[model samples]
Target: MTSEIQSYNFNGASLRTLTDGAGEPWFVAKDACDILGMSNPSMAVTALDKDEVAQIDPKDYLGSENRSNQAVNIVSEPGLYKLIMRSRKPEAKEFQRWVTHEVLPQIRKTGGYIPTSESDSDEDIMARAVL
Candidate 1:
């Protein structure tokens, strides 16, 4: 299946986003940490609660230049928000506004899951919607 991927700039920092087979938007951990102003990108996952840690995973995608694809840790839709919450930078708030008010709502309108909380997995959210 062809996954649609793209690069986006948040407050001058570049990050990559991709839509997985499940139509989930997986955000690159490295780019997310960079944009969020985390000195150590690896800490983004480790800092999370143990449960949040488990929900996170990695996926590969072509870089901005498309030079080659690399495997980078990515967070699920819910994990994306959790990572953003870790950021102390003011841009974190703006980033959250754009994603929640704009990006995610559009994705949901297309029959995709819009994760509402850390406990709400994509599957769980979608399943509840169906009921």
Candidate 2:
């Protein structure tokens, strides 16, 4: 019904992750950029291939204060992998391995994503984002 965020730690990076009801994974673009050693995610996403952008979208997330955090462009599974593939970080391969061999498969098996509380429900978050 709404977007969700699941903060996952990889090595030392804190990745803001997401999964829809269909178990498709997405990541907060800025967080992804930060993890991959980029300075500007907004500019970076613009440089992505058009086909890549087609699968991604920009959405606002509700932060701990229960208010709309800055809008973070969200990337879909393909975009996540593409960003990883384009990265030269030593952990790129390791990140891919974890997400593919572990996180993704686990989500697929589970079938849905659940956020922490009613404050994070899609409608609630979307409402805050709109405000």
Best by lDDT: 2
Q: Write the per-residue lDDT of candidate 1 for residues 13-70, one digit (tens) a residue.
A: 7777776676656676777777666777666788665433322223324534444344
- For candidate 2, the TM-score is 0.57
- Number of the top candidate by TM-score? 1
In candidate 1 the C-alpha lDDT for residue 91 amounts to 58
Q: Global lDDT for candidate 1?
A: 0.64
Deviation (Å) of 91 in candidate 2:
5.2
Which stretches of candidate 1 lie above 4 Å from their native place?
A: 1-4, 48-60, 63-70, 104-131
Per-model CA lDDT versus the true structure: 0.64, 0.65
RMSD of each: 9.8, 9.5
For model 1 the TM-score comes to 0.57
Q: TM-score for all predictions?
A: 0.57, 0.57
Give a tens-digit lDDT track for model 2, residues 1-131: 14566677777778776666676666677778887776778887886766454333333343452344345576776877788778777756677677677766756986433322444778875564455
